[model samples]
Target chain A: MRVGVVTFPGTLDDVDAQRAARVAGHEVVALWHGDHDLQGVDAVILPGGFSYGDYLRAGAISRFAPIMTEVIAGAQAGLPVLGICNGFQILVEAHLLPGGLLRNDHRKFICRDQTLRIENTSTAWTGAFAQGQEIVVPLKNGEGQYVADAETVARLEGDGRVVARYVDVNPNGSVNDIAGISNERGNVVGLMPHPEHAVEALTGAGTDGLGFFTSLAGVLA
Target chain B: MPKPEILDPQGKAVLGALPRLGFTGVTDVRQGKRFEIEVPEVTEAVLAEIAKMADSLLANTVIENYTVRVEQDA
Candidate 1:
Protein backbone atom coordinates (compact mmCIF):
# COMPACT_ATOMS: atom_id res chain seq x y z
CA MET A 1 0.00 0.00 0.00
CA ARG A 2 1.09 3.56 -0.71
CA VAL A 3 0.96 5.73 2.42
CA GLY A 4 1.20 9.50 2.11
CA VAL A 5 3.03 11.27 4.91
CA VAL A 6 2.00 14.92 5.20
CA THR A 7 4.61 17.59 5.86
CA PHE A 8 3.57 20.91 7.30
CA PRO A 9 5.88 23.82 8.00
CA GLY A 10 7.83 22.89 11.15
CA THR A 11 6.79 19.27 10.87
CA LEU A 12 9.63 17.20 12.33
CA ASP A 13 8.16 13.69 12.21
CA ASP A 14 7.20 13.21 8.57
CA VAL A 15 10.56 11.65 7.78
CA ASP A 16 10.27 9.26 10.70
CA ALA A 17 6.77 8.25 9.65
CA GLN A 18 7.91 7.73 6.08
CA ARG A 19 10.81 5.60 7.27
CA ALA A 20 8.43 3.50 9.37
CA ALA A 21 6.08 3.08 6.44
CA ARG A 22 8.97 1.94 4.21
CA VAL A 23 10.10 -0.47 6.90
CA ALA A 24 6.57 -1.84 7.06
CA GLY A 25 6.77 -2.60 3.32
CA HIS A 26 4.57 0.20 2.05
CA GLU A 27 5.36 2.79 -0.60
CA VAL A 28 5.90 6.19 1.02
CA VAL A 29 4.54 9.30 -0.66
CA ALA A 30 5.36 12.81 0.50
CA LEU A 31 2.42 15.18 0.76
CA TRP A 32 2.70 18.95 1.31
CA HIS A 33 0.46 20.98 3.60
CA GLY A 34 0.13 23.87 1.17
CA ASP A 35 -1.32 21.64 -1.54
CA HIS A 36 -4.84 20.28 -1.64
CA ASP A 37 -3.77 17.21 -3.55
CA LEU A 38 -3.34 13.94 -1.69
CA GLN A 39 -1.08 12.53 -4.47
CA GLY A 40 -3.54 9.67 -4.92
CA VAL A 41 -2.10 7.62 -2.08
CA ASP A 42 -3.93 4.70 -0.57
CA ALA A 43 -3.77 6.10 2.98
CA VAL A 44 -2.57 9.18 4.84
CA ILE A 45 -0.49 9.65 7.99
CA LEU A 46 -0.29 12.97 9.81
CA PRO A 47 3.00 12.79 11.67
CA GLY A 48 4.00 14.67 14.78
CA GLY A 49 5.93 17.95 15.32
CA PHE A 50 5.41 21.59 16.23
CA SER A 51 3.27 22.31 13.24
CA TYR A 52 2.70 26.07 12.72
CA GLY A 53 5.11 26.58 15.61
CA ASP A 54 2.38 25.40 18.04
CA TYR A 55 1.13 28.98 17.92
CA LEU A 56 -2.37 30.23 18.75
CA ARG A 57 -2.90 26.67 19.97
CA ALA A 58 -1.28 23.37 19.23
CA GLY A 59 -2.62 22.21 15.88
CA ALA A 60 -5.05 25.15 15.67
CA ILE A 61 -3.49 26.83 12.65
CA SER A 62 -2.40 23.67 10.93
CA ARG A 63 -6.00 22.49 10.88
CA PHE A 64 -6.62 25.18 8.27
CA ALA A 65 -3.85 24.08 5.92
CA PRO A 66 -4.96 23.27 2.40
CA ILE A 67 -3.99 19.63 2.77
CA MET A 68 -6.42 19.15 5.66
CA THR A 69 -9.38 19.74 3.36
CA GLU A 70 -8.37 16.72 1.36
CA VAL A 71 -7.56 14.76 4.49
CA ILE A 72 -10.91 15.53 6.05
CA ALA A 73 -12.75 14.58 2.90
CA GLY A 74 -10.68 11.46 2.38
CA ALA A 75 -11.11 10.36 5.97
CA GLN A 76 -14.86 10.82 5.73
CA ALA A 77 -14.86 8.62 2.63
CA GLY A 78 -13.21 5.72 4.54
CA LEU A 79 -9.65 6.55 3.54
CA PRO A 80 -7.53 5.55 6.52
CA VAL A 81 -5.81 8.35 8.47
CA LEU A 82 -3.49 8.01 11.44
CA GLY A 83 -2.64 11.11 13.45
CA ILE A 84 0.19 11.00 15.96
CA CYS A 85 1.18 13.63 18.59
CA ASN A 86 0.77 17.09 17.10
CA GLY A 87 -1.09 15.42 14.26
CA PHE A 88 -3.55 14.09 16.85
CA GLN A 89 -4.10 17.63 18.02
CA ILE A 90 -4.86 18.61 14.43
CA LEU A 91 -7.35 15.80 14.09
CA VAL A 92 -9.29 16.98 17.13
CA GLU A 93 -9.02 20.62 16.15
CA ALA A 94 -10.32 19.77 12.69
CA HIS A 95 -13.36 18.07 14.30
CA LEU A 96 -12.40 14.78 12.66
CA LEU A 97 -12.18 13.46 16.23
CA PRO A 98 -13.93 14.53 19.38
CA GLY A 99 -12.41 16.18 22.48
CA GLY A 100 -9.43 18.54 22.90
CA LEU A 101 -5.80 18.42 24.04
CA LEU A 102 -4.74 20.66 26.91
CA ARG A 103 -1.32 21.38 28.34
CA ASN A 104 0.15 18.57 30.38
CA ASP A 105 -1.49 18.60 33.80
CA HIS A 106 1.81 19.41 35.46
CA ARG A 107 2.36 22.25 33.00
CA LYS A 108 5.60 20.71 31.81
CA PHE A 109 6.75 19.07 28.60
CA ILE A 110 7.34 15.39 29.23
CA CYS A 111 9.53 12.98 27.28
CA ARG A 112 9.74 9.35 28.17
CA ASP A 113 9.15 5.79 27.09
CA GLN A 114 5.43 5.49 27.67
CA THR A 115 3.34 2.33 27.87
CA LEU A 116 -0.07 2.11 26.27
CA ARG A 117 -2.73 -0.57 26.34
CA ILE A 118 -4.37 -1.46 23.07
CA GLU A 119 -7.97 -1.09 24.12
CA ASN A 120 -9.51 -1.47 20.68
CA THR A 121 -7.69 -3.05 17.73
CA SER A 122 -10.53 -2.93 15.26
CA THR A 123 -9.41 0.48 13.96
CA ALA A 124 -7.50 0.69 10.71
CA TRP A 125 -4.24 1.78 12.35
CA THR A 126 -4.24 -0.81 15.12
CA GLY A 127 -5.18 -4.02 13.26
CA ALA A 128 -1.84 -5.65 13.98
CA PHE A 129 -2.18 -5.62 17.73
CA ALA A 130 -4.27 -8.04 19.73
CA GLN A 131 -6.73 -6.45 22.11
CA GLY A 132 -5.19 -5.69 25.53
CA GLN A 133 -1.65 -5.67 24.11
CA GLU A 134 0.68 -3.34 25.95
CA ILE A 135 3.25 -1.45 23.89
CA VAL A 136 5.89 1.07 24.85
CA VAL A 137 6.42 4.11 22.66
CA PRO A 138 7.87 7.58 23.01
CA LEU A 139 5.58 10.27 24.40
CA LYS A 140 6.80 13.85 24.25
CA ASN A 141 4.71 16.99 24.23
CA GLY A 142 3.40 19.91 26.31
CA GLU A 143 -0.21 20.03 25.12
CA GLY A 144 -0.76 16.30 25.27
CA GLN A 145 -3.57 16.12 27.83
CA TYR A 146 -6.81 14.82 26.37
CA VAL A 147 -10.10 16.32 27.58
CA ALA A 148 -13.77 16.03 26.70
CA ASP A 149 -17.14 16.60 28.24
CA ALA A 150 -18.25 13.80 30.54
CA GLU A 151 -20.97 12.69 28.15
CA THR A 152 -18.55 12.50 25.27
CA VAL A 153 -16.15 10.42 27.33
CA ALA A 154 -18.93 8.04 28.20
CA ARG A 155 -19.92 7.81 24.56
CA LEU A 156 -16.39 7.10 23.39
CA GLU A 157 -16.09 4.34 25.95
CA GLY A 158 -19.52 2.87 25.29
CA ASP A 159 -19.02 2.92 21.52
CA GLY A 160 -15.71 1.04 21.80
CA ARG A 161 -13.98 3.85 19.96
CA VAL A 162 -11.21 4.35 22.48
CA VAL A 163 -8.21 2.81 20.75
CA ALA A 164 -5.66 2.99 23.54
CA ARG A 165 -5.14 4.03 27.13
CA TYR A 166 -2.05 4.99 29.08
CA VAL A 167 -0.59 2.18 31.12
CA ASP A 168 0.72 2.40 34.72
CA VAL A 169 0.56 6.20 35.03
CA ASN A 170 -1.27 8.88 33.10
CA PRO A 171 1.68 11.05 32.06
CA ASN A 172 -0.36 14.00 30.83
CA GLY A 173 -3.48 13.64 33.00
CA SER A 174 -5.63 12.63 30.04
CA VAL A 175 -9.17 11.90 31.18
CA ASN A 176 -9.91 8.22 31.72
CA ASP A 177 -6.21 7.67 30.99
CA ILE A 178 -6.90 7.87 27.28
CA ALA A 179 -3.78 7.99 25.13
CA GLY A 180 -5.57 7.45 21.83
CA ILE A 181 -8.99 7.13 20.25
CA SER A 182 -10.65 6.27 16.95
CA ASN A 183 -13.48 7.83 15.00
CA GLU A 184 -16.79 6.02 14.91
CA ARG A 185 -16.03 4.57 11.49
CA GLY A 186 -12.70 3.16 12.77
CA ASN A 187 -10.76 4.43 9.73
CA VAL A 188 -9.29 7.35 11.65
CA VAL A 189 -7.06 6.83 14.69
CA GLY A 190 -5.46 9.57 16.75
CA LEU A 191 -2.82 8.93 19.37
CA MET A 192 -0.67 11.27 21.44
CA PRO A 193 2.40 9.01 21.43
CA HIS A 194 4.94 8.88 18.59
CA PRO A 195 4.65 5.36 17.23
CA GLU A 196 6.93 6.18 14.30
CA HIS A 197 9.82 6.77 16.67
CA ALA A 198 9.52 3.31 18.20
CA VAL A 199 9.36 1.22 15.05
CA GLU A 200 13.04 0.21 15.17
CA ALA A 201 14.97 -1.48 17.95
CA LEU A 202 18.24 0.19 16.94
CA THR A 203 17.12 3.79 17.51
CA GLY A 204 13.83 3.69 19.37
CA ALA A 205 12.88 2.47 22.82
CA GLY A 206 11.43 -0.74 21.38
CA THR A 207 9.91 -2.35 18.31
CA ASP A 208 6.53 -2.23 19.99
CA GLY A 209 5.36 0.56 17.68
CA LEU A 210 6.03 -1.37 14.50
CA GLY A 211 2.52 -2.75 14.74
CA PHE A 212 1.05 0.70 14.06
CA PHE A 213 2.76 0.75 10.68
CA THR A 214 2.54 -2.94 9.87
CA SER A 215 -1.11 -3.03 10.78
CA LEU A 216 -1.86 -1.07 7.61
CA ALA A 217 -1.20 -4.15 5.52
CA GLY A 218 -4.33 -5.80 6.89
CA VAL A 219 -6.32 -2.55 6.79
CA LEU A 220 -5.52 -2.02 3.13
CA ALA A 221 -6.12 -5.62 2.20
CA MET B 1 -17.09 25.12 39.24
CA PRO B 2 -13.70 26.38 38.11
CA LYS B 3 -12.71 23.08 36.54
CA PRO B 4 -10.42 21.46 39.05
CA GLU B 5 -8.75 19.73 36.10
CA ILE B 6 -7.83 23.02 34.48
CA LEU B 7 -4.83 24.61 36.11
CA ASP B 8 -5.36 28.03 37.65
CA PRO B 9 -1.76 29.10 38.19
CA GLN B 10 -2.54 32.61 37.10
CA GLY B 11 -5.39 32.81 39.56
CA LYS B 12 -3.31 31.22 42.30
CA ALA B 13 -0.56 33.74 41.78
CA VAL B 14 -2.98 36.60 42.20
CA LEU B 15 -4.49 35.00 45.27
CA GLY B 16 -1.07 34.54 46.82
CA ALA B 17 0.05 38.11 46.17
CA LEU B 18 -3.20 39.55 47.49
CA PRO B 19 -2.24 38.97 51.14
CA ARG B 20 1.17 40.62 50.69
CA LEU B 21 -0.44 43.60 48.98
CA GLY B 22 -2.71 44.23 52.02
CA PHE B 23 -5.93 42.95 50.41
CA THR B 24 -7.21 40.72 53.18
CA GLY B 25 -9.80 37.93 53.37
CA VAL B 26 -10.33 37.44 49.63
CA THR B 27 -11.06 33.74 49.44
CA ASP B 28 -10.29 32.97 45.82
CA VAL B 29 -9.58 34.21 42.35
CA ARG B 30 -10.85 32.70 39.14
CA GLN B 31 -9.09 34.23 36.18
CA GLY B 32 -10.71 34.42 32.77
CA LYS B 33 -10.84 36.65 29.70
CA ARG B 34 -12.83 39.56 28.37
CA PHE B 35 -13.53 40.59 24.80
CA GLU B 36 -14.86 43.83 23.37
CA ILE B 37 -16.55 42.55 20.25
CA GLU B 38 -17.94 45.28 18.05
CA VAL B 39 -20.98 44.50 15.97
CA PRO B 40 -23.09 46.72 13.73
CA GLU B 41 -26.16 47.69 15.81
CA VAL B 42 -26.22 44.65 18.05
CA THR B 43 -29.23 42.49 17.16
CA GLU B 44 -30.47 39.04 18.06
CA ALA B 45 -28.90 37.63 14.93
CA VAL B 46 -25.56 39.29 15.74
CA LEU B 47 -25.60 38.03 19.32
CA ALA B 48 -26.23 34.48 18.12
CA GLU B 49 -23.38 34.79 15.65
CA ILE B 50 -21.02 36.06 18.33
CA ALA B 51 -22.02 33.19 20.61
CA LYS B 52 -21.34 30.72 17.83
CA MET B 53 -17.93 32.29 17.24
CA ALA B 54 -17.07 31.86 20.90
CA ASP B 55 -18.33 28.28 21.05
CA SER B 56 -16.56 27.22 17.85
CA LEU B 57 -13.30 29.20 18.05
CA LEU B 58 -12.67 31.68 20.88
CA ALA B 59 -13.17 29.22 23.72
CA ASN B 60 -12.24 25.55 23.77
CA THR B 61 -15.41 23.92 24.99
CA VAL B 62 -13.48 21.02 26.41
CA ILE B 63 -11.41 23.02 28.90
CA GLU B 64 -13.08 26.40 29.06
CA ASN B 65 -16.47 28.06 28.82
CA TYR B 66 -17.18 31.74 28.09
CA THR B 67 -19.88 34.27 28.61
CA VAL B 68 -20.84 37.07 26.21
CA ARG B 69 -22.05 40.55 27.12
CA VAL B 70 -22.75 43.37 24.68
CA GLU B 71 -22.66 47.07 25.36
CA GLN B 72 -23.35 50.12 23.25
CA ASP B 73 -20.29 51.45 21.46
CA ALA B 74 -19.30 54.80 22.95
Candidate 2:
Protein backbone atom coordinates (compact mmCIF):
# COMPACT_ATOMS: atom_id res chain seq x y z
CA MET A 1 0.00 0.00 0.00
CA ARG A 2 1.07 3.57 -0.57
CA VAL A 3 0.89 6.10 2.27
CA GLY A 4 1.18 9.87 1.93
CA VAL A 5 2.46 12.14 4.64
CA VAL A 6 1.63 15.82 4.27
CA THR A 7 4.37 18.32 5.10
CA PHE A 8 3.30 21.82 5.93
CA PRO A 9 5.86 24.64 5.93
CA GLY A 10 6.71 24.15 9.61
CA THR A 11 6.12 20.44 9.94
CA LEU A 12 8.79 18.63 12.01
CA ASP A 13 7.67 15.01 11.90
CA ASP A 14 7.00 14.27 8.25
CA VAL A 15 10.34 12.56 7.76
CA ASP A 16 9.87 10.41 10.83
CA ALA A 17 6.35 9.51 9.71
CA GLN A 18 7.69 8.58 6.29
CA ARG A 19 10.37 6.37 7.81
CA ALA A 20 7.81 4.66 9.99
CA ALA A 21 5.61 4.03 6.96
CA ARG A 22 8.55 2.46 5.16
CA VAL A 23 9.35 0.30 8.18
CA ALA A 24 5.81 -0.99 7.99
CA GLY A 25 6.38 -2.06 4.37
CA HIS A 26 4.53 0.63 2.49
CA GLU A 27 5.73 3.04 -0.15
CA VAL A 28 5.78 6.57 1.24
CA VAL A 29 4.95 9.79 -0.57
CA ALA A 30 5.82 13.30 0.58
CA LEU A 31 2.95 15.70 0.01
CA TRP A 32 3.09 19.47 0.23
CA HIS A 33 0.69 21.65 2.15
CA GLY A 34 0.06 23.91 -0.83
CA ASP A 35 -1.02 21.02 -3.05
CA HIS A 36 -4.60 19.80 -3.18
CA ASP A 37 -3.81 16.38 -4.60
CA LEU A 38 -3.54 13.22 -2.50
CA GLN A 39 -1.14 11.61 -5.01
CA GLY A 40 -3.55 8.68 -5.13
CA VAL A 41 -2.21 7.20 -1.88
CA ASP A 42 -4.23 4.62 0.01
CA ALA A 43 -3.87 6.49 3.29
CA VAL A 44 -2.71 9.88 4.64
CA ILE A 45 -1.04 11.16 7.76
CA LEU A 46 -0.88 14.73 9.01
CA PRO A 47 2.37 14.69 10.91
CA GLY A 48 3.20 16.81 13.95
CA GLY A 49 4.84 20.25 14.15
CA PHE A 50 4.22 23.97 14.52
CA SER A 51 2.56 24.34 11.14
CA TYR A 52 2.46 27.93 9.91
CA GLY A 53 4.39 28.62 13.11
CA ASP A 54 1.24 27.87 15.09
CA TYR A 55 0.01 31.30 14.02
CA LEU A 56 -3.48 32.49 14.95
CA ARG A 57 -3.94 29.33 17.00
CA ALA A 58 -2.37 25.94 16.51
CA GLY A 59 -3.58 24.29 13.34
CA ALA A 60 -6.06 27.12 12.75
CA ILE A 61 -4.34 28.47 9.63
CA SER A 62 -3.13 25.07 8.52
CA ARG A 63 -6.72 23.87 8.48
CA PHE A 64 -7.40 26.14 5.51
CA ALA A 65 -4.51 24.90 3.40
CA PRO A 66 -5.41 23.52 -0.03
CA ILE A 67 -4.36 20.01 0.98
CA MET A 68 -6.97 19.82 3.70
CA THR A 69 -9.74 20.25 1.15
CA GLU A 70 -8.58 17.04 -0.46
CA VAL A 71 -8.02 15.43 2.90
CA ILE A 72 -11.59 16.16 3.94
CA ALA A 73 -12.90 14.69 0.73
CA GLY A 74 -10.67 11.65 1.02
CA ALA A 75 -11.63 11.03 4.65
CA GLN A 76 -15.31 11.21 3.67
CA ALA A 77 -14.66 8.46 1.15
CA GLY A 78 -13.37 6.07 3.88
CA LEU A 79 -9.69 6.83 3.47
CA PRO A 80 -7.78 6.61 6.75
CA VAL A 81 -6.23 9.76 8.19
CA LEU A 82 -4.04 9.79 11.30
CA GLY A 83 -3.27 13.15 12.87
CA ILE A 84 -0.59 13.59 15.51
CA CYS A 85 0.11 16.58 17.79
CA ASN A 86 -0.36 19.76 15.75
CA GLY A 87 -1.98 17.60 13.12
CA PHE A 88 -4.55 16.66 15.73
CA GLN A 89 -5.09 20.33 16.41
CA ILE A 90 -5.65 20.89 12.70
CA LEU A 91 -8.15 18.07 12.58
CA VAL A 92 -10.13 19.72 15.33
CA GLU A 93 -9.85 23.12 13.67
CA ALA A 94 -11.19 21.58 10.48
CA HIS A 95 -14.09 19.97 12.37
CA LEU A 96 -13.12 16.54 11.08
CA LEU A 97 -12.85 15.60 14.73
CA PRO A 98 -14.60 16.93 17.80
CA GLY A 99 -13.27 18.88 20.83
CA GLY A 100 -10.77 21.69 21.21
CA LEU A 101 -7.24 21.51 22.56
CA LEU A 102 -6.24 24.19 25.07
CA ARG A 103 -3.15 25.36 26.89
CA ASN A 104 -1.78 22.89 29.41
CA ASP A 105 -3.36 23.57 32.74
CA HIS A 106 0.14 23.65 34.18
CA ARG A 107 0.89 26.65 31.96
CA LYS A 108 3.97 25.03 30.48
CA PHE A 109 5.04 22.76 27.65
CA ILE A 110 5.30 19.08 28.60
CA CYS A 111 7.40 16.33 27.06
CA ARG A 112 7.64 12.77 28.22
CA ASP A 113 7.00 9.14 27.39
CA GLN A 114 3.38 8.47 28.14
CA THR A 115 1.41 5.25 28.44
CA LEU A 116 -1.99 4.97 26.83
CA ARG A 117 -4.65 2.30 27.00
CA ILE A 118 -6.14 1.30 23.71
CA GLU A 119 -9.82 1.87 24.29
CA ASN A 120 -11.30 0.98 20.92
CA THR A 121 -9.27 -0.83 18.27
CA SER A 122 -11.86 -1.01 15.52
CA THR A 123 -10.64 2.11 13.75
CA ALA A 124 -8.81 1.85 10.44
CA TRP A 125 -5.48 2.65 12.13
CA THR A 126 -5.81 0.53 15.25
CA GLY A 127 -7.55 -2.69 14.22
CA ALA A 128 -4.49 -4.81 14.98
CA PHE A 129 -4.59 -4.16 18.70
CA ALA A 130 -6.88 -5.78 21.21
CA GLN A 131 -9.03 -3.58 23.41
CA GLY A 132 -7.34 -2.36 26.63
CA GLN A 133 -3.85 -2.78 25.23
CA GLU A 134 -1.17 -0.46 26.66
CA ILE A 135 1.34 1.30 24.48
CA VAL A 136 3.95 3.95 25.09
CA VAL A 137 4.39 7.03 22.94
CA PRO A 138 6.01 10.41 23.36
CA LEU A 139 3.67 13.19 24.41
CA LYS A 140 4.90 16.72 23.89
CA ASN A 141 2.96 19.93 23.46
CA GLY A 142 1.85 23.08 25.25
CA GLU A 143 -1.81 23.08 24.28
CA GLY A 144 -2.61 19.41 24.66
CA GLN A 145 -5.55 19.60 27.00
CA TYR A 146 -8.76 18.50 25.26
CA VAL A 147 -12.17 19.88 26.13
CA ALA A 148 -15.71 19.52 24.80
CA ASP A 149 -19.29 19.86 25.96
CA ALA A 150 -20.54 17.17 28.31
CA GLU A 151 -23.10 16.03 25.79
CA THR A 152 -20.45 15.60 23.11
CA VAL A 153 -18.25 13.69 25.50
CA ALA A 154 -21.13 11.42 26.41
CA ARG A 155 -21.93 10.76 22.81
CA LEU A 156 -18.33 9.94 21.96
CA GLU A 157 -18.16 7.51 24.82
CA GLY A 158 -21.48 5.94 23.87
CA ASP A 159 -20.43 5.45 20.26
CA GLY A 160 -17.00 4.00 21.13
CA ARG A 161 -15.31 6.83 19.29
CA VAL A 162 -12.65 7.16 22.02
CA VAL A 163 -9.59 5.35 20.73
CA ALA A 164 -7.15 5.82 23.59
CA ARG A 165 -7.04 7.01 27.19
CA TYR A 166 -4.05 8.20 29.15
CA VAL A 167 -2.81 5.92 31.87
CA ASP A 168 -1.10 6.65 35.21
CA VAL A 169 -1.50 10.47 35.20
CA ASN A 170 -3.29 13.00 33.10
CA PRO A 171 -0.44 14.88 31.48
CA ASN A 172 -2.35 17.86 30.09
CA GLY A 173 -5.60 17.79 32.05
CA SER A 174 -7.69 16.50 29.17
CA VAL A 175 -11.28 15.81 30.11
CA ASN A 176 -11.83 12.21 31.26
CA ASP A 177 -8.20 11.59 30.44
CA ILE A 178 -8.98 11.23 26.74
CA ALA A 179 -5.78 10.85 24.75
CA GLY A 180 -7.13 9.98 21.29
CA ILE A 181 -10.38 9.62 19.42
CA SER A 182 -11.65 8.31 16.09
CA ASN A 183 -14.40 9.68 13.90
CA GLU A 184 -17.75 7.97 13.87
CA ARG A 185 -16.89 6.11 10.71
CA GLY A 186 -13.61 4.95 12.33
CA ASN A 187 -11.54 6.07 9.35
CA VAL A 188 -10.08 9.25 10.88
CA VAL A 189 -8.07 9.23 14.11
CA GLY A 190 -6.40 12.07 16.00
CA LEU A 191 -4.13 11.99 19.00
CA MET A 192 -1.88 14.50 20.75
CA PRO A 193 1.00 12.11 21.41
CA HIS A 194 3.95 11.69 19.02
CA PRO A 195 3.69 8.07 18.01
CA GLU A 196 6.23 8.50 15.21
CA HIS A 197 8.91 9.35 17.76
CA ALA A 198 8.44 6.10 19.61
CA VAL A 199 8.53 3.66 16.73
CA GLU A 200 12.14 2.50 17.11
CA ALA A 201 13.66 0.75 20.06
CA LEU A 202 17.14 2.11 19.30
CA THR A 203 15.71 5.59 19.83
CA GLY A 204 14.98 4.37 23.43
CA ALA A 205 11.27 5.16 23.79
CA GLY A 206 10.36 1.56 22.76
CA THR A 207 8.80 0.28 19.56
CA ASP A 208 5.23 -0.13 20.81
CA GLY A 209 4.14 2.73 18.59
CA LEU A 210 4.93 0.65 15.51
CA GLY A 211 1.65 -1.13 16.04
CA PHE A 212 -0.14 1.92 14.61
CA PHE A 213 1.72 1.66 11.31
CA THR A 214 1.81 -2.12 11.18
CA SER A 215 -1.87 -2.32 11.94
CA LEU A 216 -2.52 -0.55 8.67
CA ALA A 217 -0.56 -3.23 6.89
CA GLY A 218 -3.12 -5.79 8.02
CA VAL A 219 -5.98 -3.54 6.96
CA LEU A 220 -4.53 -2.85 3.52
CA ALA A 221 -3.51 -6.45 2.92
CA MET B 1 -4.29 39.92 26.58
CA PRO B 2 -6.48 37.93 24.22
CA LYS B 3 -10.28 37.97 24.18
CA PRO B 4 -11.64 34.60 25.17
CA GLU B 5 -15.14 33.61 24.27
CA ILE B 6 -17.63 34.58 27.01
CA LEU B 7 -20.16 31.86 26.45
CA ASP B 8 -19.00 29.68 29.33
CA PRO B 9 -22.05 27.49 29.72
CA GLN B 10 -21.26 26.51 33.28
CA GLY B 11 -20.64 30.12 34.36
CA LYS B 12 -23.75 31.28 32.56
CA ALA B 13 -25.93 28.72 34.21
CA VAL B 14 -24.75 29.77 37.64
CA LEU B 15 -25.39 33.45 36.90
CA GLY B 16 -28.81 32.65 35.49
CA ALA B 17 -29.79 31.07 38.78
CA LEU B 18 -28.91 34.26 40.69
CA PRO B 19 -31.86 36.22 39.29
CA ARG B 20 -34.31 33.52 40.32
CA LEU B 21 -32.91 33.72 43.84
CA GLY B 22 -33.93 37.39 44.36
CA PHE B 23 -31.56 39.25 42.01
CA THR B 24 -33.40 41.40 39.42
CA GLY B 25 -32.96 43.21 36.01
CA VAL B 26 -30.02 40.97 35.19
CA THR B 27 -31.30 40.79 31.58
CA ASP B 28 -28.30 38.93 30.12
CA VAL B 29 -24.85 38.57 31.61
CA ARG B 30 -21.51 37.29 30.43
CA GLN B 31 -18.08 37.17 32.01
CA GLY B 32 -14.50 37.50 30.76
CA LYS B 33 -11.54 39.75 31.47
CA ARG B 34 -8.83 41.61 29.57
CA PHE B 35 -5.35 42.78 30.55
CA GLU B 36 -3.58 45.93 29.36
CA ILE B 37 -0.06 47.20 29.92
CA GLU B 38 2.16 50.04 28.80
CA VAL B 39 5.69 49.61 27.50
CA PRO B 40 7.89 52.51 28.53
CA GLU B 41 9.64 53.21 25.19
CA VAL B 42 8.54 52.62 21.59
CA THR B 43 11.71 51.12 20.17
CA GLU B 44 13.43 47.77 19.66
CA ALA B 45 13.03 47.47 23.41
CA VAL B 46 9.23 47.39 23.02
CA LEU B 47 9.39 44.65 20.41
CA ALA B 48 11.52 42.61 22.73
CA GLU B 49 9.00 43.13 25.50
CA ILE B 50 6.16 41.96 23.27
CA ALA B 51 8.12 38.89 22.26
CA LYS B 52 8.57 38.00 25.90
CA MET B 53 4.84 38.40 26.42
CA ALA B 54 4.13 36.08 23.52
CA ASP B 55 6.51 33.48 24.88
CA SER B 56 5.35 33.71 28.47
CA LEU B 57 1.60 34.27 28.51
CA LEU B 58 -0.11 36.24 25.75
CA ALA B 59 -0.28 33.08 23.63
CA ASN B 60 0.15 29.39 24.19
CA THR B 61 2.94 28.78 21.70
CA VAL B 62 2.03 25.13 21.53
CA ILE B 63 -1.62 25.61 20.65
CA GLU B 64 -2.61 29.27 20.19
CA ASN B 65 -1.05 32.21 18.30
CA TYR B 66 -1.66 35.88 18.90
CA THR B 67 -1.46 39.34 17.38
CA VAL B 68 -0.44 42.54 19.24
CA ARG B 69 -1.74 46.04 18.67
CA VAL B 70 0.03 49.06 20.10
CA GLU B 71 -1.42 52.57 20.24
CA GLN B 72 -0.11 55.83 21.62
CA ASP B 73 -2.44 57.91 23.81
CA ALA B 74 -1.54 61.44 24.67
Model number with the top TM-score: 1
Model 2 docking category: incorrect
* Candidate 2 TM-score, C-alpha based: 0.77
Q: Per-prediction DockQ scores?
A: 0.37, 0.05
Q: Give the Å shift of residue A101 in candidate 2.
A: 0.6
Scored by DockQ, the top model is: 1
Q: List the residue pairs that clash in candidate 2.
A: A57-B65
Consecutive 10-residue window with the lowest summed lDDT within model 1 chain B: B1-10
What range of 10 consecutive residues in model 2 chain B has the weakest lDDT sum?
A: B1-10
Model 1: residue A123 alpha-carbon error in angstroms: 0.5
For every model shown, what is its TM-score relative to the native structure?
0.87, 0.77
lDDT for each candidate structure: 0.89, 0.83
Native A-B contacts reproduced, model 1: 0.32
